[model samples]
Target: MKSAARHAIDLAGFEAKFRAGPDPWHTLTARDEAIKRQRILRALGDGPIARILELGSGNGSNSQALARRALKLHTCDGSASATQLTRQALADAPNAHAWHIALPAPLPGHRYEAVVIAELLYYLAPRAMQRLAKDVANALAPGARLVLAHHQIEFPDNTQRTAGIHDRFINALGRSVTKVRQFRSQRWIVDGYRA
Candidate 1:
């Protein structure tokens, strides 16, 4: 399959969307999105995560929830506006920090107890995806958790399906990573792994 990075929406496109509206994807009001967030949290469980790195900080809805469960939450997005919104959402939590960055690039340089990549992997090309998988594996501390959530449907801008994205991470992480939790529905898939 071809990489979506070649033709998928670029950083400017994402920034424009965020600039146009606070909740471009209706992340706060969408039923499926709510369900997806719930599933992601459930997969991560109720324990306290010392450090968390979230790859996509969409309007900070998920980030806000994650911040409550983590001692330190670092979240980033390609859109500056999104990052601003994330910061606003997490204003009460001094432990949460948001950065604006173009993804498919290197992740933040820090080993984390947990990492969450949600609704963001399909935008990456195979090479970028592989690189990210490697980065994620390296960033994970021993016994750390990696949680992934992606929509199952194919879209024009997406390079891979949910299953394909999860498989790529599993393959890249090799035998050291093991599945800890999973949830699948017609709309989306959420998988958790332990390193």
Candidate 2:
């Protein structure tokens, strides 16, 4: 399917899913999600992050943990309900804020020390993915890191294949992004890129 066509269809599907309830991907209860979270944290290392951005923060489970470590954390999701759930989940975390954003749109105005895209890339179409690559490149501060994690198995709703999604970013960023770490499991692949 074309990028725009797929985006429209997926947006409607996702909106309904978000409206139904948070944790659409069951991140809170899934063992794989937990492992993915741990791997991402490990990839980020033990450095004190001044500011971080988490794209497609589904239910804020990861956001809550990241908020504890960072001085400031901003999470964005395409679904309004998802963002609301994220806000509620991180309500007591003074440093965290969740915003509702449609995919392919511009990121927040501030540059980030670390940007995370976990289990979110495959859902984005080709055009949106290009925009994301450009936006992320522009949004990263000097020596900032971008972590991308995704399920290796293709899903019906996925607009792009897992390898293709990651490859696009690697190709777009080129020498500007350095591969910091990579971990692969039977179900998921996590890669960290520093710019």
TM-score of each: 0.91, 0.91
Compose the digit string of candidate 2's lDDT tens values, residues 1-195.
543333333767877888887777798989988998888887776877999999988778799888987899999988788888899999999988888998668887569999998877778777778778888888899988889988888665677877667888667653488888998899898888888
Number of backbone clashes in candidate 2: 0
Task: Give model 2's TM-score versus the native structure.
Answer: 0.91
User: How well is each residue in 26-47 modelled by candidate 1, as lDDT tens digits?
Assistant: 9988998888888898888678
Q: Which one is best on lDDT?
A: 1
Model 1 Cα shift for residue 87 (angstroms): 0.9
Cα RMSD (Å) per model?
Answer: 3.0, 3.3
lDDT of each: 0.85, 0.83
Off by over 4 Å in 2: 1-9
**Residue-level error in angstroms, candidate 2, position 38:** 0.5
Evaluated at residue 193, the lDDT of candidate 2 is 81
Candidate 1 has a TM-score of 0.91
